[model samples]
Target: MIRTESLTKRFGPVVAVDSVSLHVREGDRYGFLGPNGSGKTTLVRMLLGLVYPTSGTIEVMGRRMPARAAEVLPEVGSLIEGPAAYPYLSGRRNLSLIDAIGSRDKRSARRARIENVLGQVGLAGVDERPVKAYSLGMRQRLGLAAALLREPRLLILDEPTNGLDPQGIREIRDLLTELNKAGTTVFLSSHLLSEVEQLCTRVGVVDRGKLVLEEELTALRAPTGRILVESPDADKITGILNGRLVSRAGEHIVVEHEDAAELNAWLVGEGMRIASITPERRSLEEVVLAATGPGADRLDR
Candidate 1:
C-alpha cells in the first residue's frame, strides 16, 4: 500500500534522507526504526505531503505522492510529532471539528462516527472533558481517535507511545493489532525497540540519512545461544571455547557457536559438568544496531 523509490530529502548542504526506498503491503504492521535525527520523521513528512522530497518518488495507496497527495491523503490518517488539538475545546468537540473538515458525512453520521472512535480509543466517558484537562495518554488516545474518524485505509503513527504509561502503551498496542486484523495498514515510526519488537511484523532501520535494513522481525530475531557453565575450572573451559566465545560475564560465557550439541558433548567428555546452560536470542535492538553500523551514532545528531 506504500512504496518509495530513492526518496531523497536535504536541508542546505546536509542530507536528511538519501536514496531511501521502502515498500509496505496491505494489512502490514510496518515499523520504521531509527535513532534521533535519522530522517524517519522527514520521510514520513514526505509521504504525507507535508514536505516535498528533493528527488525520487513516493506512492501511497496506488497514488503518487506530492503529485496526487491531495487525492490520496484523505485516505490516510497520521499523527506526526505529537497530537495537535484545541486546548479549550472538549475532546468531543475537537473530533467533531475534524470530522466536519475532513469528512463529508452528515452531522448525525459524523457524531456516530465520533462516538464509535472515542469508544474504540477508550475515551467514551471522557469525551466531554476539555482537551486541556486530558493527560498525555488521554491526548494520545484522542489523537488516535481523530485519526480513525474517517475510517482511513492507512494509519501513520509517529511515536504514538511517547509519554504513555505501561497500561496506555499496551492499550494502544492492542488497538493497533485489532486495526491491522481488520485490514487497516499501519505504518509505525518510533524509537522504542521493545515496542517495535512486540508490535511489528516487519521493520525498516534507518541511519545516517540512509536506509540500512528492511526485513521481517522474525528474520531479524533468529535464535542464537549463550551458555552459562559453572565448573571447578572455569578458566580452563574458557580456553577450550576461545574463538567461539563472544564474551564473558564473570564465570558465565556467551558464545556464538553454530553447533551447540557438539560443544556440549565436547565439554562433557572433557570432564566439565555443566550446572546451567541458557540460550540467548538476538533482539530487535541488537539487529538494528548491527545493521546500521557503528556510525549510526549520527542518529543522535
Candidate 2:
C-alpha cells in the first residue's frame, strides 16, 4: 500500500532520486532492487520520512508521507542503515531498551515484548547473553527483533541479511516469508538477486535514480522454453517440426516452444530415436538484466 508520483530528491546539485513512480499493493512481498548508488535507499528514506523529497508525492498506507507520518509510520517497522544495540547490554536488555521507543508507548508491556521478539528472532534462550559476546548473525537477529518489537503492519527492511552467512540468509528469508504470509506487508531492498528471486512475489527495478520496471515476479519468470532435442534422425525431426522459430543446429534440433513434452512426443511419433531433450528458460536475473541493460552492475552489497 505504497504509491509515489514522480518522487524526486536532491542533495544540492546531486539528485539521489529522480522522477520515479512506484506502486506496491497490499499483501505483496515486494522487492525494491537496483545497482550500487542507484538511489534505492534514498527512495526508501523518503517513504519513511527520514528525508524529505525535493518534489512529488508519496502515499503510504493511504496516508501522505511526512505530512501523515505520525498516522502512517506508527504502523510501520523499519531497519534502515543497520541495527543498533548497546554492546554492554544483554540481548534481552538491549531489546527492552529499544522497545521503550515503540509506537505503542506502553512501557508496562516492554518485558513481554522483549521476550516475544527474542523468541520470534530465534534468540529466546540466549537473549540474556551480552551483545558484545554475540556473533554478527546474532546482532542482525537482534536488529530484527527491535524492528518486530512494535509488531507494525508494514516492514521496511534495507539489506536485512547484510553480512550474514548462507544459513543466516536462509533463516532471514524464511522469517520474512512467514511474516508476509501472516499479513505483514514486506518491502525489502536487497543486493542479492537470488534472494529477491526466491522471496519476493513482486519486484520494482531501479536504475540511474529512475524506476525502470515494476511487475509480478511470476509474469517476469513465465515459461518461455527453448527445447533442444538430440537424435540420430535429426533431419527427419527438424523437417517435421520446421517452423519460423524452429531450426536444426548440428545433430540437434532447437525449437522455441513452451511444452517440452509435446515437442518431444512429436519427434518420437515419427519412429525417431531421441537422444535427449532439454528445456531452457530465462531466469528472473536474466529478465532483469535484459530490461536494465548494461547499467546493471554487481549488486552484491
Candidate 3:
C-alpha cells in the first residue's frame, strides 16, 4: 500500500530522512518507530507531500507522490502531530467542517456519518459538547473521526494513542485492529513499544534519520533456549552450570543447553539455593534499542 526508495530529506547541513526504503503491504498494521528527531514525522510528511523529498521516490496506493499528491490524498487518511479543532465549535460542528473538505457527502446516508464516526471513536454521548470542553483523549478521538470521514482506504496515524488513558488506548488499539481486519491498511508511528508489540504485525525502526531495521514482528522476536535463573547466589549458580551452555547476564544465569527441569534438578542436587527459574524471550524494546542506538546504521533485519 506504501513504498519508498532511497528517500531522503535534508535541511542544509542536517538530513532528516536518509535513503530510507520501506514497504507497507495491504492489510498490514504497520508500526513506524523511533525516538524524537529520528525523522519519522519528516518521512511521513514527504509521503503526504507536506514536504518534498530531497531525492528518491515515494509511492502511495501505487501512485508516485508530489506528482499525484492531489489525486492520491483523497484516498489516504492521516492524523499527524495532534488533533486540531476550532475551540469554539461543538464536536458535531467540528465534524461537519471536515465533511465540507471532501466532495463526498456522507450527510444523506449516515445519521450524518458524523454520528457514525463519533460512535466509532466512542464520542457519540458527547457529540454536542464544545470542542474546548473535550478532554485530550476525546480530541484524539475527534482527530480519528476526521480521518475516517471519507472512509479512506489507507490510514496514516502518528501517535494515535497520544493522550489516551489505558482504557482509551485499548479502545483505539482494538479499533485499529478491527479496521485492519476489515481491509483498511494502517500505518502508524508511535513511541509506545508495548502498544506496537500488541497491535502491529510489521515494524520499521528508524534512527539518526536512517532506516536501520525492517522486519516482521514474529521474526524480530527470536526464540531462544535462554532460561533465566534468579538467585542471590547467581554467580555460584553460573559456576555450577558452566559445564553446560550457561552464561551470566546481570543477576541471572542464562542457561542455554539445559531445560528448566534439568537446571533446577542440578541446582537442588548440588545443594545450592534456588529462587526462580523462568524462560526468557528477548523483548521488542531490546531489539529496538539495539537497532536505533549508536552505530544504528550497522544493524539490519
Candidate 4:
C-alpha cells in the first residue's frame, strides 16, 4: 500500500535518495534492502513524512504522504533504527503514556490494548521494572509492542531483530509472518539477507541511493537449470545419467536438468532409491550481490 515515483531527496550538495520508484502491495511482506550509506534511512524518513523529499511523490494507503499524514499515519506502524521510551518508566507505563498520546480510543480500553500488544511482541506478564533494567532485547520488544499498540494496517520496520538471540529473532519473524497473513502489509528494511529471504514475499534492493532491483522473491530465485539429488543409488544413478551428470559427492549428485520432476521420475523408473531431489536456485544473497556493488561502508586503500 505504498508507492513512490522518481522519489529523490538531497542534503546540501549530496543526494541521499536518487530517482527511485518503489511499490509495495497491500498484503505483501516487502523487504527493503540496502547497505550502510545506501540511503535506506533517508527513504524511510521520507515515507514517514519525517523528512520531505526534494522531488517526486509518495503515496501511502492510496493518499499523498506528509500532506495527509494525520489521516494516514495513524493506521501505519513503524520502528526506525530502534525503539525509544522513557528509560526510567516501566514498560507498561511507557506504553500507557504512548498509547494516550493522540489516541482516540476509550480510556477504559487502553489497558487491554496495551496488554494484547505486549503479549503479541513476547512481553506478556512482564514485570513493572523500569525500562533501564531491561536488556536490549527487552527494550526492542517494548518498542515493537508500542508499534503494535494501534493495530496498524501497515508496518514499516528497520533492523527489527537488532538485539536478540536466534530464538528471539525467530519469535519476531513468526510474529511478523502471522501479522502479514492476517492482512497487515509489512515493509521490512534490513541488512540481514537471510531474514528477508525467509520472511519477505517481495524484495527491493537499493545501492548508491538508487533502486537497483525490485521483484517477487520467487521470480528472483527461479531455478537455475540444475538439480540436487540425494539417493542411496548414487553410483547407479550416475551411470544412468552420465552425459547429464555435473558432479557426484558420495550420496549427493548434481545434474544439469531443466526439470526436477522429470529427472525424479526417470530415476524412480530406473529402480533408484532417491532420498530427495530439488531444483537448484540462486540464494537471495547471490541475487542481491549480482544486482548491487560494494556497500558504502567499505573503504579501500
Candidate 5:
C-alpha cells in the first residue's frame, strides 16, 4: 500500500528524481529497478522520509509520508544500504539492541522474536558469534532479522541479496515470498534483474531519473513463439522464412516469430522436411530491455 504522485527530488541543479509516480497494492511483492545513479535509492529515501522531496506527494500504508512519517514509519521496516550492526557485539546482542530501540514488548519476548527471525533468515545457531566474525551473507541475514524485529506491515529492502551466495540468496528470496504470502507488503529495490524476476509480482523500471516502464512480471515475461529449426539446408530455410536468423548452433537455426505454427506450415508448404523444431519464450530481462530500448546500456554506470 504505497503511492506516489509526480515525486521530484533535486540536488541543487541536478534532478535525481523527476516527476515519478508509483503504486504498490497490499501484499504485493513489487520490484523497483533502475541503473546506477538513476535515483532509485533517492526515491526510496523519500518514501521513508529519510530524504524530503522537492515537490510531490507520498502515501505509505494509507498514511501521508513526511507529514506523518513518525507514525507511519513505525509500521515499516527498512534496510537502506547494507546491514548496520555493532561489530563487537554478538549477533544476538545486535538484535537485542535493535529490539530495545524499537521498544519491543519485553526482554524475553524480544529475544524470542529475534531468535525466530534469525532462524527464519537461516542464522539459528550462529547468534552467539560476534558480528565481526560473521560473513557478508550472515550480516545480511542479521540485518533482515533486525528489520523484522518490529513486525512492520511494510518492508523496504534495497539490494537485500547483495553479497549473498546462491544458497543465501535463495534463503532470503524464500523468506520474502513467505512474508508477502502472509500479507506483508514488500517494496524491494534491486539492481539484479534475475532476483527481481524470480521474486516480484510486479516491477517498475527507471532510467535517467525517469519512470520508463511498469507492468506485472507475468505479463512482461509472457511466452513468445520462438523456433529452432535444424535441417541440412539451413540456408534454404532461412531464405524461405523471410525472417532474421538470430543465431546458429551447429546446423540449427534460431528464429523469433509471432506464430510458430505459421512458420512451420510455411516450411512444410515449401517441401522442406523439418528435422526438429523447438519453441522458446522471452525472459524478463529481455522484455525489460526491449521496453526501455537501447538506453539500458546506460544503466551500468
Candidate 6:
C-alpha cells in the first residue's frame, strides 16, 4: 500500500533520511525498526507528506505523495511522534472537533463512530475529564482512537504503545492484529524488538539513516542447522555424538545438525531415551542488532 524509492530528507547539512526504499504491501503488518535518531520518524513523516523530502519519490496507494496528499491521505491513518489534543477540552470534545474536519461522514453517525473507536482503544469508560487530567496511557489511547476514527485502509503508527502498561500494550496489539486480519495494511515503526517480533509479518531494519535489511520474519528466524536437545541420558548421547555436540550442560545439549527429525529418529533407533529435541532458530533481537549499529542515544569515547 506504500512504496518509496531512494527517498531522502536533509535538514541543513545533516541527512536525517538517506536514500531509503520502503515497501509495504496491502494487508502486510510491516515493522519498520531502528534505534533512536536512526531516521525512523523522519522517514515516516516523509511517507505521510508532513516533511518534504530533499529528493526521491513517495507513493501511497498508487498515488504520488505531497502532490496527491489531499487525495490519498484521507485513506491513511497515522500517529507520528505522538498525539496532540487541546489540553483544556475533554477527550470526547477533542474527538468531536477532530471528527468534523474534512470528514464526509454523515453527522448523525459521528457520535457512534467516535464511541466505537474510543472503545476499541480502551477508553470507553473515560469521563468528561479534560485531556490535561488524563494520564499518558490515556493520551496514547486517545491518539489511537483518532487514527481509527475513519477506519482508513492503511495505518502508519510510530511508537504506538509508548506510554501504556503491559495490559494496554497487549490490548492495542490485539486491536492492530484484528485490523490487519480484516485487510487494513499496517506500517508500524518502533524501537521495541519484542513487540515487533510478536506482531509483524515482515520487517525492515534501518541504521544511521539507511535501510540495511528487509526480510520476512519467518525467513529471518529460520533454523540455523542446529538442534537443542533435552534428554535424561545426556552423558550417553554426548558420548555417542561427541564430535557433533556443540555444548552440554547437564541434560540439555546443543548439537550441530542440519536435520532435527533425522537426529531424533537416529537417537530413538539407537535406543537412547529422548525427552525433547527442537531446531534452534535465531531470535529477532539477534537479527536486528546485527543489522543496525548502536542507537544515536548511545555515547562512545
Top-scoring candidate (TM-score): 6
Worst 10 residues of 5 by lDDT: 292-301
Give all candidate RMSDs, comma-separated: 3.2, 3.5, 4.4, 2.0, 3.3, 1.3
Residue lDDT tens for model 3, 191-289: 999999999999999998889999999888855667778778777776766565466777767777437787688888888778898776778899898
Counting only residues 3 or more apart in sequence or on different chains, how many pairs clash (N, Cα, C under 3 Å) in candidate 2? 0
Model 2 per-residue lDDT tens digits across residues 13-108: 988899999999999999998877789999999999999999999999999999999899878988887888899889888877666663465666
Q: Is candidate 1 or candidate 6 better by TM-score?
A: 6
Please give the range of 10 consecutive residues that has the lowest summed lDDT in model 3.
292-301
Number of the top lDDT candidate: 4
List where candidate 3 sits over 4 angstroms from the true fold: 104-106, 229-242, 245-253, 258-278, 294-301
TM for every model, in the order presented, reads 0.86, 0.86, 0.86, 0.92, 0.86, 0.96
Better of 3 and 4 by lDDT: 4
Q: Write the per-residue lDDT of candidate 5 for residues 1-301, one digit (tens) a residue.
A: 9999999999999999999999889989999987677889999999999999999899998989999998998789898889999999999998887788748387788878888988988888884668999888888888888888788899999999888999889989999999989889999999789989899999998887889888898887665656778887787877765656787766798887766678778788888877877676667777767755445346563
Alpha-carbon local distance difference test for all models:
0.86, 0.85, 0.87, 0.94, 0.85, 0.92
lDDT of 3 at 190: 97
Can you tell me which runs of candidate 5 are displaced by over 4 Å?
A: 102-104, 224-226, 229-249, 256-280, 291-301
In angstroms, how far off is 24's CA in candidate 2? 0.6
List, residue by residue over 51-74, the lDDT tens digit for candidate 4.
999999999999999899999999
Clashes of 3: 0
Candidate 6 — worst ten consecutive residues by lDDT sum? 292-301
lDDT of 1 by residue, 1-301 (tens): 9999999999999899999999998989999988777899999999999999999999999999889988998889889999999999999999888889856677899889989998998888884678999898889988999889878899999999887898888888999999999889999999888998999999999997788899888877765655545565567788887587787767677766655577677888998877666556788988888877555454563
The lDDT ranking, best first, is 4, 6, 3, 1, 5, 2
Q: Model 6 lDDT vs. the true structure?
A: 0.92
